[model samples]
Target chain A: MSTDLSVPVFTNQSEEELGGKWGMVIDQDLCTGCQACVAACSMENNIPFVGETDAAYGRSIQWIRIERFWQGSFPEVKMTPYQPMMCQQCHNAPCEPVCPVFASVHSASEDINLQVYNRCVGTRYCANNCPYQVRVFNWRDYADARVRPELVTLQNQLNPDVTVRRRGVMEKCTFCIQRIRHTEDVAKSEGREIRDGEVVPACAQACPADAIIFGRIDDPNSRVSQAGLASRGYHQLEELNLLPRVTYLKGESNNGSNG
Target chain B: MIKKFFDALNQPLGRVGLLIAALVVLSGAVWGIAQAQKPPEQPIQFPHKLHVGLGIQCLYCHPGALRGPSPGLPTESKCWGCHQQLQRFADPTTPWPTELQKLRDYVQQGKPIQWIPVAQVPDFVHFVHRPHIAAGLNCETCHGDVSKMTVYENPQVINMGWCLNCHRAKTEDNSQNNPTNDPAVSAMLAEKRTKLTDCSTCHY
Candidate 1:
């Protein structure tokens, strides 16, 4: 391993050429900004609601958030299409190299970025280094029923598949890895490859307009790959060479409603 | 007061006393950990030896293990169905054991018996028993033989290292282990090894 930080040590040009195993394509045009994906993500991943005060402090632990910007000014102002942002699951993730412990890592099998919660020591370096700013840290024991009495009843609704993270742990979107693992296991048991559309993340499943599409991007025949081939599809931070797996389709303002 | 305490520690006797205090604290911590490792007491003293001796299979009671992550505890009705037909319970002349009496009370009250799970992994570890079973692992492979024991207890501490040890053993490509050296078998083993050792496999 090279000590010189200027040169990337773990960069795999082959992986970049081959493309990622799992990929997502989000159609910004179809997104209604209803926050359905946000709600579903929280429920599915056992994400704690950090109350109004903490949320005001920008400490809300939402894995995915809808980001929209205003264009022009005053009467001519128009809202840009809702861009639901989450962990990009970059092939060469900037977050992976910064962790003091190997908490933020790349999964060899899945070919995706992983945050091993048990290995995390609350350094927050990964969160700071993340270009997408998707990583969220648990500043308080927000999930504990004793700390937040209101969560006592809500605790029952927690998905047992996902671990309820405690204070001082950094977490981000896992691409609903639990669902991926479950579908893979089922497919393996039946002696067949995982079919396209079999594994659906919480956000993709809850989308009313079916804006989110997740599948094997390596497979050219897969829906996600077909969607990624569109001229409008582009990576969030393509200049940095992060090789993010997520492809966002540009929303045209010429839909006539904006005028 | 702090100065006086440090001055006292300069004496040989004070040093001996400090060493004794340190030893006492260390032993107390060790004892606490030992107690934590002990199997928790269940509501009913369910005898595994008696049940296994009577030729009852583990799957009969915990059927969920075959299909899903949790091997669910049998319902009280399942217990009563057998106990009600037993010669010991049918005859009024025969006296019921204290444990059997407790079971009877629970069934009568329509209360679920609280069975404390002995073998458990942390919340971070997502252990699915279905794959292990599908891989042709007997119940006794991870869970020790139940026929010899009374109350259910883990054969050993269920930790990440222990899980990895078995995973490594099965996946190792050695000529002695793989006599045939079949390419297909080796390929399958290699794939299994990668999946098994991957952190995301157990931890999400």
Candidate 2:
């Protein structure tokens, strides 16, 4: 029997060739490693506070984390610029393939990797497969008020736009798909295209230094596209050929000699 | 004990008892599912038929449907706004209906009516009503004909399959649907189909 070529299949094509819809640019030079983005992301996404014990064990469900490296050694030691790490929204995400349930699937329309909570069977295969190590699994019912009595009062602040994920589901940065969808809906209702800087993710919005930029990367006029074109701009782990949507601008090292 | 249990299954009378027990469990499961599907009892048992028949638009009660995800329930004042002005409630000699009395009590007590939503999708499904309404869908399309019923009920099970069915139908390319056969229109429809079918569109 002849193969039906009309049927759609997943391809490992690079996002640069396909042109991603949503993209982010984080300026490492401007980031202060304050962790505001992490806090904002948790509140906006309804990510539970896994407590000190779980967090110490590396069970904290932070969608965005700041990575700080040390520059030089001993006497001349200095802190390197802070780099914010998150799900790169890769066009050919490594996590997408390993999910047997297809819970970690790519959205063709949005061009972003999605973690379908209801579909996830807690296999944690996607988390292990991810090169970025951005995916966090719900080790317990952290958001459930019945399990966590203190969360009952905090539940009032939960964002209704984003789903409160339960135990066993592996989740990661969605690039604020809810905000993107809301902006798209509003733009559609007004019979216009989404304007530049119209859809900002929680991390980008909460950045005090204005280090993070988010917008349609396909549009050359967008802020994210312009930032991505900077000479210092580079993707984390670019050698992997994941085609990460996040572009990080290199920051100048502050060695002791500079002081 | 295990061998004795197996031995009892060998007898005809024991087999009949086992069959009866299995049937009871199967019927109980079926009944449980049916009970879950039944419409939940609302606090007011608000008469949709009378209000809809009176020519009041659905948007008047649920203005949020046109603007956001939730179609907010009308406040007690909104209900009292019309009820207090009504000729039936105006006359001291006439008594208010039980449902209207509940509304008056709520308004007087300064408490909000805790309305139980009928057509609700799970938390994972981020359903927004504005887009559906903007797509030229009438109130009765998904919510059924409120004009005919007293209490609101779902027209169909609000599941992924039901949603996908409508999305597929709307996005499908048909000669009858698109008589002009314009390339630009077809391209737009194709793009829309992708957006509508994409998992992230509904489930964030």
Q: Against the true two-chain complex, what DockQ does each candidate achieve?
A: 0.77, 0.88
TM-score winner among the candidates?
Answer: 2
Q: Per-residue lDDT tens digits of candidate 2, residues A237-258?
A: 8888888899988744522111
User: What overall lDDT goes with each candidate model?
Assistant: 0.89, 0.89
Model 2 alpha-carbon miss at residue B151, Å: 0.8
Evaluate model 1: give its lDDT: 0.89
* Model 2 CA lDDT for position A160: 93
What candidate 1 gets wrong by more than 4 Å, as runs, is: A1-16, A73-75, A251-259, B1-3, B7-16
Candidate 1 residue pairs in clash (backbone atoms < 3 Å): none
Q: Interface RMSD for every prediction, one decimal?
A: 0.7, 0.6
